[model samples]
Target: MKKIALLLFPFILFTFSTFAQSANEDWISLFDGESFDGWEAAENPETFSIEDGKIAVHGPRAHLFYMGAAENHDFDDFVFKADVMTTPGSNSGIFFHTQYQEEGWPAHGYEAQVNNSFDADPRRTASLYNVDDNTEVIFPDDEWFTMTIQVEGQHITIMVNDEVITDYTEPEDVDRGTNVLSSGTFALQGHDPDSKVYFKNIKVKPL
Candidate 1:
């Protein structure tokens, strides 16, 4: 019996390793810390910068988007995540299923609110902007926290620090005005001149 068990051990270990590798491959990074090689900014490109291996936002309105050639910057059902840190009174957002424009707030896609202590906005991090707003303060500003967005079909889930903040299901007949839920790329918001936010480890797994 001992000899038989030893013979199967290698197969079991190899199976586990293979599963781990497959899982790791599902998540593809969209940002390179040193530069914006895979990303581009809207009008005011100067609002974005690289500091301490992170994308820093601290200027007038602008949006940094993933235009990488890897995925063609197009996505529909997917899981997106990033490590975010906001200074006091800062406001920002994570826009998914969105396209790029020369300027102005993205008229398409969904926005995950990233305001922690900004006095102007009550909807805190992981809130799906106006769709499903979240007001409870789960995390503080100036601290690194993980914000995740998962979209499967018409359902959407938003999480912060692994805590679910919003779970929404779009109705078939819902009206989105000019903003429509369709396949697109990802973007990071530089809300205003007063708001300062940082993002790192931006990655996505298309479903």
Candidate 2:
């Protein structure tokens, strides 16, 4: 009986360890369904808000930001996934490695373009915006679309709804304006007036 109990103890310990690791490995939800506890606005708290279990970008021309101060969780190599929906002709973006600037847009960062309209320009959505990297069309506006960005070192790839869009590597010694590609905070853009955007299911895993 003593020998059998000793053997079972190891098995029980192993099972508990496995279960704990699995729970921690799961994706962390950035937004709580009830409140914006882990976020903040770029300029003012009035710009961004939580509405009906989703982060809503209101106003027509204000650049509202979701503050990421809880972890200061900067990533060097990781995979980011989010579900996004926007109004027609609305122009916004997902900014990464962004630094705050006073009274203007964040000068330092890269924007994952988010625009969806038949008349919308190619650079309007899913394009690397001024960085000159273009990907095939894979935007499903008027509904929810999954946007995934994978960054490994200097190489970055973006996929919209399982469709590969921008896949390019940063040129060595090239200037990235104010946008620091290696590491910084992540944010959602609120461009111009009347532009409403919704973001949900945002999760990130380190590479």
Candidate 3:
């Protein structure tokens, strides 16, 4: 009996160690280079199209989603990275902890904004969209930029082209008018008609 217990103890420890290692792996690709298999659109009625090995938002619609049925997955803390390109006045965002609904902007999740210049709105690019403030202009429209967002607990960090732009932690007990750093599905926002946004090399690492 003593020998059997010893063997089981090591087996349990090894199993847990392997699980921890898998959770910390760097950069799991969200976009499969061929399809939007694991992603979903958000509030906009706009359609997300795949062309030339890239996922793009095209055509006219409010908001659309490509999520798994019945909220099967959600992320609480993770590092998300994607390469995005947009037209001059194009506006889009990476929405986290997103709740899917019909016809309206997501009231639950947070948006890691995407914009170019100050063309559409001064708060256009890289802004936290009403939750926090955006001060720097780090996006160059029509040019590819690498955007990275790290969410750990209640703290969030936004980086563009490896440059730290927006770093904020949500205030505890403060009402941001929505859910705060809970957990839900991840989404890509397609804002308005005629707004074209392209996403590639999308990856995430859970913390």
State the displacement of the C-alpha of residue 62, model 2, in Å, after optimal TM-score superposition: 3.8
Candidate 1 residue pairs in backbone clash: none
Clashes of 2: 9
TM-score order of candidates, top first:
1, 2, 3
What 10-residue stretch in candidate 1 is worst by lDDT?
174-183
Provide the overall lDDT of each model, using Cα atoms, as 2-decimal numbers: 0.91, 0.71, 0.74
Q: What is the C-alpha RMSD of each candidate to the true structure, in Å?
A: 1.1, 4.3, 6.9
Model 3 vs truth, CA RMSD: 6.9
* TM-score of every candidate relative to the true structure: 0.96, 0.79, 0.79
Candidate with best TM-score:
1
For model 2, the stretches where C-alpha displacement exceeds 4 angstroms are 1-26, 64-71, 118-122, 133-137
* Collision count of model 1: 0
lDDT of 2 by residue, 1-207 (tens): 999999999999999999999866765566766776755565544556777777777664445444554346565677788889977767778877665543467776788888776245567567877785463445656798898887888888888887878887887887756664767667777776566788888777767
**What is the number of backbone collisions in each predicted candidate, taken in the order shown?**
0, 9, 12
Error of 2 at 120 (Å): 6.4
